[model samples]
Target: MQFLVKSARPETLKTATLVVAIGEGRKLGAAARALDAASEGTLSALLKRGDLAGKPGQTLLLQGLAGVKAERILLVGCGKERELSERSYRKVAAAALAVLKTLGGSDAALTLGELMVKGRDAYAKARLLVEVLADGGYVFDRFKGDKAEAPALTRITLLAEDTDLLACERGAAHAQAIASGMAFARDLGNLPPNLCHPSFLADEAKALAKGNKALKVEVLDEKKLKELGMGAFLAVAQGSEQPPRLIVLDYKGGKKDDAPFVLVGKGITFDTGGISLKPGLGMDEMKYDMCGAASVLGTFRALVELGLPINVVGLLACAENMPSGGATRPGDIVTTMSGQTVEILNTDAEGRLVLCDTLTYAERYKPQAVIDIATLTGACIVALGSHTSGLMGNHDGLIRQVLKAGETAADRAWQLPLFDEYQEQLDSPFADIANIGGPKAGTITAACFLSRFAKKFHWAHLDIAGTAWVSGGKDKGATGRPVPLLTQYLLDRCQ
Candidate 1:
C-alpha cells in the first residue's frame, strides 16, 4: 500500500473517497464541518434523522453529496470531542479504514489525522493512521484455494497542515516500516512447522541480509554449537532431524565504535514440550513457539529500513524441541556456554534452556544492553493474559526504559517483580540451577533463570508467551507484538 500527506481542505481534495470524523454528540470536527457546509448540512441532517449516531467505531457512508468532488464520504465516530483519547482516536481511524476497504475505491483521502488526540501530536496521529491501515490491510490467504481479490484501496492520503507535513511524512514512513516488520514477523510465525524449521529460519535471516549492506547474517549448526559448549541448547535440538541453528544478525548503522544493543530470542521453531510432551490439544499452535525469534528478525527488518543510526545485534537461539529417543528427558543436566549447569527437571521448560546458552554468548558483544525475548512460560499468559508482555529484568533503569517504550508504542508490557526472592525458587541442589522453578511464580522464575546468565550486562527479558499470538477464533494468528515496542526503544536511543 502507498501513503501520502495532503495539505488542503477536505472538501477541496479530489479523491475517490473522503474520510472525516464526527464526535459522539453529533459535533463535526473541522474537516467534517467544512465538508458538511459544502454539502449544505448533509451530515447534520443525516444525524438528526437518526441515520447515523456518532458513537465510537460507528461509521456511515454517503455517496455523491451535493458539493463534494469525492465519489463517497465516510464519517467515523470519534466519541466526545472533549474526551477523544488516543485509543478512541485509533478506533475512529480503524472504522474509517473499514469503510474504505469495502468501497472498491482505488484510493482515499483521510482528514481524521487533523482530529486532536489527547497528548498526541500531528505526526503521531498520522503515524497511527497509516499503521492501522497497514495492519488492517494485511491478508494471509496464500494457502487458501479461493483467495479473495486484492483490496481496491491501495493508496492513502493523510490530510495535515503545512507546518505538520514533514513530521507526518516522517511518521508515515516509520509506521510503514514498522507495519512491514510486523507483517514479516507474522508471516514467519504463521508458517506451518514443516515449513518454518531451524534451517528455514536461518535461510530467512540470510535472505533478509541479502543486498542489505548494513546487515550481516551468520548461522551456527549443531557441530558449531557443541564446539561452543551450548549443551543446554544442543539438548533441545538433538531430538529433531532438522539440526539447530544459532542465528546472528548484525545491523551496523551507528557510529563505528558504538556498543551495540543486543537482542536475544528463543527460536523454538516447533516445541512439542520435548519428552515432557504437551497435551495434544492446542499443540498445533506450537508453531508460534518461535515468535520470539520472529520478533527479533522483524525488528531488524524495520531498523534496516528506517536506516536507524544505532547499532543492534539480534541473536536467535533457533531450535526444535521434539519428543524423541534423543530428546533430553526429565532429570537430565546440561552445561551452558557460561559453564553453568542446569537441571532439566521437565523437558518442556526448554525455552530458557535455549536462551540461557545464548544469553551467555551475548556477553561476548560487550553490549550497551541485552534484552531477550521468549515465549518462555504459560504462567506468563495466565498472569498477563494476551494483551501485555511480561517484563522482568535485573537492571531497573533498562527495565523502565523498555516499559516506557512499550507504552509509547501501545505494545505494552507489565513489569513483573525481579526481586531476589523470586530467584530462590530457581535454586537446585544438583546443579547451578534448575530449568523449571516449580509452578508458583513460574514466569518470574523463568526470568530469574535467565538473569543468572545476563549478570554481566544491562539486561531485561520480555516473556511474550501471551502477546505473541492468538490460539483460536477468526483472529487466531501471530500478533507481531513487542516489535513495535522494541523498534520504538531503538528509535528513541537513536534520537
Candidate 2:
C-alpha cells in the first residue's frame, strides 16, 4: 500500500473515501465539524435521526453529500474526545479501515491522525494508522489452493495541518518500513515446518544480504558448530535430518569501531519436544517456535530500509527438535559454546540450550548490549497471558530501555524478576546447571539459565511464547511482535 501525508481540508479533499472521527454524544471532531458545516448540517440531521451512535469503533457511511468532494464519507466513532487513548485510537482507525475494505474504493484519506491521542503526537498517530491498516490487510494464504482476495484499498493519505505535515510524513515513511518488516516476519513464521527449517532460514539471511551493501551474511554449519563446541545447540539438531544453522547478519551503518547492538534469536523451526514429547494436541502450532528468529530478521529488514546509522548484528540459532533415536534425551549432559555443562532433564526445554550457546557467541562482538528473543516457556503464557511478552534481564538500564521501546511501539512487555534467588531452580547435582528449572517460575528460571552465559555483557531476554502467535482459531497466525519494539529501540538509539 502507498501512504502519503498532506495538508488538506476535509470538505474539499478529493478522494474515493474520506474518513473522519466522531466523538460520543454526537460530538463531531474538527474535520467532521468542517464537513458538517459545509453540508449545511447533513451529519447533524443523521445524528438527530439516531442513525449512528458515537461509540468507539462504530461507523456511519454517507454517500454523495452535496458539499463534500469525497465520493463517500466514513464517520468512525472514537468514544469521548478527552478519553481518547492509543488503544481507542487504534480501534477507531481499524474500524474505519475494516469498512473501507468492503467498499469499491481504491484510495482513502484519513483524518484520524488529526485527532488528539493522549501522550501521542502527530507522528505517532500517523505511524499507528499505517501499522494498523497494514496489520488488518495481512493474509497468509500462500499454501492455499485458492488464495484470498486482496483488499481494494491501496493508497492511504493522512490529512494533517501544514505545521504537522513533516512529522506525519516521517511517521508514514517509518511505518511503511516497519510494516514491510512485519510482513516478512509473519511470512517466515507462518510457513510450514518442512519448508522453513534451519537451512532454509540460513538461505533467507543470504537472500536478505543479496544486494544490500550494508548487510553481510554468514551461516555456520554443523561442522563449524562442532568446532566451536556448540554441543547443546547440536544436540537439539541431532534428531532431525535437516542440518542446523547458526545464521549471522551483520549491519554496519555507523562508524566501523562502534560497538554493535546484538540480537540473538532462538530458531527452533520445528519443535516436537525431542525425547520429552509434547501433547499431540496443539503441537501443530510448534512451527511458530522460530518466531523469535523471524522477528530478528524482520527488525533487520526495517533497520536497513530506514537506513538507520547504527551497527547491529543478528544471530539466529536455528535447529529442529525431533524425538528420534539420535535425539538428546532426559538426563543427558551437553557442553555449550560457553563451556558450561547443562543437564537436560526435559528435552522440551530446548530453546535456552540453543540460545545459551548463541549468547556466549555474542560476547565476540563486544556488543553495546544483547537482547535474546525466544518462545522459551509456556509458563510465560500462564503468567502474562497473550497480551504482553515476558521480559527479564541482568542490567536495569537496558531493561528499562527495552521496556520503554515496547511502550512506544505499542507492543508491550512486562519485566519478570531476575533476582539471584531464582538461580537456584536450575541446580543440578550432575552438571553445571539444569536445562529445565523445575516447574515453578518456569519463565524466570529460563531467563536465569540464559543469564549465566550472558554475564559478560549487558543482556535482556524476551520470552514471547504467548505473544508470538494466536493459537487454534480463525485468527491463528504469527503476530510479528517485538520487531516493532526492537526496531523502535534501534531508532531511539540513533537519536
Candidate 3:
C-alpha cells in the first residue's frame, strides 16, 4: 500500500471515501476551526451514539456528512484522550485498516491524528502508527479456492495539521520502510512450508542481498555443515532429502570494521517430530515453526530498506525434521558446531539443536551482542500464555533492551529466570549435556542449552513458540511478530 500526507481540507478531499477516528459522544478534537463550521453537527451527531471515540479498536461508519465531499466516512475510536498513548493510538490505526477491509475504496485518510505516545518523540510515534496500519492490514489467503479479490487500498493520508505534526512527517519515511518490510515478512510466513523449504528460503535471502549495495549474503549447504562439525544441526536434517541450508545475511551501515549485532532464527520448515513423533491432532500448525526465521529475515530486509546506521548480521538455520530411519533417535549423542556433544533424548526438542549451532557460527563474527528468536518450547506458552513471549538470557542488559523494545513495538514479553540451577537439568551422564532437559522449567533449560554455545557476547533468547502461531482460530496465524519488535528495538537501542 502507498502512503501520503497532505494539507488538503477534509471537505476538499474528492476521494470515493474518507476514514477518521471518532468517539461515542461525537466528541472530536477541533480540526483547526475552519472545517468545524462546514462539518456542522455531522461530527457531533455521529458522536452522539455509537461514536468512534469511546475506546481504542472501536469503530463506527458515517455516510454522507452534510457538506463533506467524500461519499462515506470511516470513524474509528481513539478511546479517552488522556488514556491515548502511542501504542494505544497505533492500535487505533490498525483498527482503522481492519475496519476498511470490506469498504471497497482505494484511497483513505486518517484525519484523526493525535499522539498518545510518551518518552518517545513525535517522529517515533508517527513512524510507529503508520507502520502498525501497514502491518495489521495484511491478509493471507494464498491457496483459498473461494476468496474475494482484496479491496483496492492504495493510499492512507495521515493528516498532520496540528503543532507537533512535523514529528509525524519526520517519522513517515521510517514508517514506510517498516510497513513494507512487515508486508514482506507476512508473505514469507504465509507461503506453504513445502514451497518455502530450506533452499528456497536461502534463495530469497540471497535475492534480497543481491539488490542492495550495503548488504551481502552467503548460503551454506550440507558439505559446509559437515566441515563445521554441525552434527547437532545436521542430525535434525538427516531425514529430509531436501538439502539443509545455513543462510547468513549481513548489513553494514556502520564503521567498516565494527562488530555487528547478530540475530539467529530457527528455520524448521516442516517438523514431523522426527523419530519422536507428535500426535496427529494439531500437526498442521507445525508449518509456523519457521516463524522465527521469517522474522529475522524480515528484519534484515527492513533494516537494509530503512538504511539504518548500524551494522547487523543475521543467520537463519534451515532444516526439515522428519521421521525416517536416518533420523536421529532418542539416546543418540551428537556434537554441535561449537564442538559440544548433546544427548538427543527427544527428537522433538530439535529447534535448539539448529539454534545452538547457528549461535556457534555467530561467534565467528565477534559481535557486540547477539539475540536469537525461535519457536523453541511449548513450556513458554504455558508460562507466559499467547499474549506474550518468554525471555531468558545470561546478560541482564541485553534482555532489558529486548524487553523494552518489545514494549515499544506493542509486542510484549516477560523476562523469565535463567538460574544456574536450570543448567543442571541438561547435564548428561554419558555426554557433555542432554538435548531434552526434562519437564520442569523446560523453557529455561532450552535457553541454558543455547547459552552453552553462545559464549562471551551479550546474548538474549526469545521463546516465541506460543506467540508465533495463534491456534485459537480467533487470531490470524503467525502473528508476523517479533519482526516489528526486533527491528524497532535495534533501530532505537542498538546504536
Candidate 4:
C-alpha cells in the first residue's frame, strides 16, 4: 500500500472513502462536524435515532449522503476525546483501517490523524496510521495456490496541514520501512521448516545483501565451525542430515571507525528437542523456533532501507535439533568456542548451546554492546506469559537501555534477576558447567549459561520464547517482536 499526507478538507478531497473521527457520547470531531453539516444533518439524524453510537473501535458507514462528495464516509469511534491515550489512538486508527478494508474502494483519505491524541505529535499519529494499516493487511498466503485476491484499498492519504506535512511524510516513510521489515521476519518465521532451514537462511541473507553496498553476508559451514572449535553448537546439529550454518550479516552504515552494535539470534529451524522429544500435539508450531534469527534479519532490512548512520552486525546461529543415533545424548560433554565445557543433561535445552558459541564468536566484532535474542526457555512462558520477553544482562547500563528501548517500542521486556545465586544452578561435577541448570529459574539460568561466554564484553539477553509466536489453530504465526525494540534501540543510539 502507498501512504501520503494531503493538506485538504474532507469535503473537498475526492476519494473512494473519507474517514473521520467521532468521540463517545456522539460528539463529532472538527472534521466530522464539518462533513456532517455539509451532509445536511444526515449524521445528526442517525445519532439522534440511535443508528450510530460512538464507542472505541465502533465504526458506522454512510454511503453517498446528501451533499457529500466522497462515495462513503466512515466514522470511527475515538472513545472520550479528552481521555484519549496512545493506546486508544492506535485502537481508533486500527479500527478505522479494519472498517476501510471491507468497503469497496480503491483509495482513501483519512482525517483521523487530526484527532487529538495526548502527548503524540502529528508525525507519531501519521506513523501509527501507516504502520497499523500495513500490519493489519498482512497475510501469509505464499503456500496457498487458491489464495484470495488483494484488497482494493491501495492508496491511503493522511490529511495534514502544511506545518505538519513534512513530519507526516517522514513518519510514513519510517513506518513503511519498519512494517516491511517485520513482514519479512514474519514470512521467514511462518514458512515450513523444510523450506526455511539453515541453508535457506544463509541464502536469504546473501540475497538480501546482493547489491546493497552497505551490507555484507558471510556463512560459516560445519567445517569452519569445527575449525573454530564450536563443539557445543556442532553437537546439537550432529543429529540432523542438514548441515548447520553460522550466518553473519555485517551492515556498515556509519563511519568506518565506529564500533558496531552486535545482535545474535538463535536459529533453531526445527527443534524436536533432540533426544528429549517434545509433545507431538503442537510440534508443527516448532517451525517458528527461528523467529529470533528472523527478527535480526528483519531489523537489518529496516536499517538498510532507512540508511541509518550506525554500524550493526547480526549473527544467526542456525541449526536443526533432531533425535537420531548420532545426536548428542544426555550427559554428553561438549566444549564451546569459548573453550568452556557444558554437560548436557537434557537435549531439549539446545538453544543455549548454539547461543553460547555465537556469543563467543560475537566478541571478535569488538562490539560496543551485544544483545542476543532466542526462543530459549519454556520457563520464561510460565513466568512472563506471551506479553513480554524475559530480559537478563550482565551490565546494569546495557540492560536498562534495552529495557527502556523495549518500553518505547511497546515490545516490553520484564527483567529477571541474574544474581550469583542463579549462576550456581548450572553447577556440574563433570564439566565446566551444565547446559540444563536444574529445573528452577530456567530462563535466568539459560541466560547465565550464555553470560559466561559473554564475560569479555557488555551483553544482554532476550528470552523470546513466549513472545515469538502465537499457538492456536488459525491464529498461529510469528509475532515479529523485539525487532521493533531492537530497531528503536539502534535509533536511539544513532541520536
Candidate 3 lDDT for residue 307: 83
For model 4, which pairs clash? none
Clashing pairs in 1: none
TM-score of each: 0.98, 0.99, 0.92, 0.97
The 10-residue segment with the lowest total lDDT in model 2: 77-86
Pairs clashing within candidate 2: none
Can you write out model 2's per-residue Cα lDDT over 280-314, one digit (the tens) per residue? 99999999999999999999999989999999999
- Which residues of candidate 3, in runs, are more than 4 Å off? 32-34, 45-58, 85-91, 115-121, 162-166, 472-476, 493-495
Model 1, span 1-495: residue lDDT tens:
999997998787889998888887788888888888998987688888876678899988888688888888888887776756778878888888778888888999988877787767887788877888898888788799999888888899988889999999998999999999999999999999999999999999999999999999999988899999999999888888989999999999999999999999889999999899899999999999999999999999999889999899999999999988888989998989999898899999999989999998998889999999999899999999999999999888999999999977878999998888888888889998989889799999998898999989999999999999988988899988879999999988987
Query: Rank by TM-score, descending?
Result: 2, 1, 4, 3
By lDDT, the better pick of 2 and 4 is 2
Please list the residue runs of candidate 4 whose C-alpha ends up more than 4 Å from where it truly belongs after superposition. none
- The local lDDT score (0 to 100) that residue 331 gets in candidate 4 is 90
Model 2, stretches more than 4 Å misplaced?
Answer: none
TM-score pick, better of 1 and 4: 1
- TM for candidate 2 is 0.99
Candidate 1: regions farther than 4 A off? none
> Over the stretch 1-495, how does candidate 4's per-residue lDDT look in tens digits?
988888987787789999888878889877888788888887788878765678889988878677778898888888776757878877888888888888779999999777777756887777767877888888999889899688899999999988999999988888888888889999999999999999999999999999999999999999999999999999999999999999999999999999999999999999999999999988998888899999999999989889999999999999999999999999999999988899999999999999999999998989999999999998999999999999999899999999988866667899999999888889999999999888788898999888899998999999999998988968889988878889888988999
lDDT values of the candidates? 0.90, 0.93, 0.81, 0.90
